[model samples]
Target chain A: EAGVAQSPRYKIIEKRQSVAFWCNPISGHATLYWYQQILGQGPKLLIQFQNNGVVDDSQLPKDRFSAERLKGVDSTLKIQPAKLEDSAVYLCASSYLAGGPNEQYFGPGTRLTVT
Target chain B: GESVGLHLPTLSVQEGDNSIINCAYSNSASDYFIWYKQESGKGPQFIIDIRSNMDKRQGQRVTVLLNKTVKHLSLQIAATQPGDSAVYFCAENPHDDKIIFGKGTRLHILP
Candidate 1:
């Protein structure tokens, strides 16, 4: 009955620094996703996981961004050598099924600022 | 190369009035659509959804209309309140799996 949970609602880092965000999804949910929302834009899918296996990560910046969903319950998204363009809100969401029309429950996103 | 986009970037409406937000999608294969509301500091929350088979669906205070012909989607909010002030986004799922979100429409309710 608890919704998805995320840590460090806000974060600030200098360019070239590294930052990581954590997410704990709702119980029994099998699909977890990470998205980036720039100011005045919609959330863009960064990665998606289904029970510890990556379902999709076509938009993820492989050179600078990485994510893992170990044990299939919690997830962590990391960005190394952050750039000014990386300053955006990172949102986490979970759904009950891996492939369905089920609604996704989102967590309070982590707002990251790179100086 | 499918994308979802909104017709309006922002909409202003008087409180107690109704609001209609429109979106267009390029993927004709999309079978599912959803509307989400996001506050200033929070992530998007699900408002309502409509499947491609159905032309319309209604919730407590929200209604979603889908037109497969023109690939158009719309959300109607009845008796809009101050709480309805937020950014609304429409997402499309081509295969009923992965979803693509629109840029979003900022809704401002004037009291």
Candidate 2:
């Protein structure tokens, strides 16, 4: 089976510029997640969606970062007026279920660099 | 504020030897734990997982051991190969349904 898919494996933008990343989760998976992984650090959960509705986004920076899972199959994460601190790899993952010990399959991720 | 952290930032082991990565979590309410392997330029890949009720779980050449009393979790890779060299992260599922991740340990395979 195919795993989660992400677009634009790498991106570069100037500070204060806007950038967006896209994710296509595995088929039939109910839970989709977006995470930001800084260099030498683990991925931090940015937002989670169960189908078309959001499940959690407490860590998301409301002032600049936003995400949406419109059809429940694909999602997009956007950062407006990106900053140098926002330089990190953005990962997308999917799981069969939301809660419990279900395993998650991750995409290749998009590496964003802000100049 | 519950958090997960690793005991060591980096570990080096000779090829063909076993490797063990340790992690400590502060949330006693966490019910599930998972180990993930992440290579350079790639996202984390699930290696093994264990539930709160179970102390251990094994898959292929990897094993996950959980100690609820100490709030510790470990991943053991037997007969490690060069391909096993990667950053390993421990994650926990708490009551809030969030999967919190540790900073991760970089495993280096020495030839």
Predicted model with the maximum TM-score? 1
lDDT of 2 by residue, A12-101 (tens): 999999999999999999999999999988899999999999888889998999999999899999999899999999999999887655
Q: In candidate 2 chain A, what residue range of length 10 has the lowest lDDT sum?
A: A96-105
Pairs with steric clashes in candidate 1 = none
lDDT of 2 by residue, B42-70 (tens): 88998888889999988999989999999
DockQ (Cα-based) for each candidate? 0.80, 0.69
- Alpha-carbon error at A50 in model 1, in Å? 0.9
Interface RMSD of each: 1.1, 1.6
User: Which residues of candidate 1, in runs, are more than 4 Å off?
Assistant: none
Question: lDDT (CA) for every model shown?
Answer: 0.95, 0.93
lDDT of 1 by residue, A1-115 (tens): 8899998999999999999999999999999999999999889999999999999999999999999999999999999989999999999999999776788899999999999
Q: What is the TM-score of each candidate against the true structure?
A: 0.98, 0.96
Q: After superposition, how far is residue A68 of candidate 2 from its true place, in Å?
A: 1.2
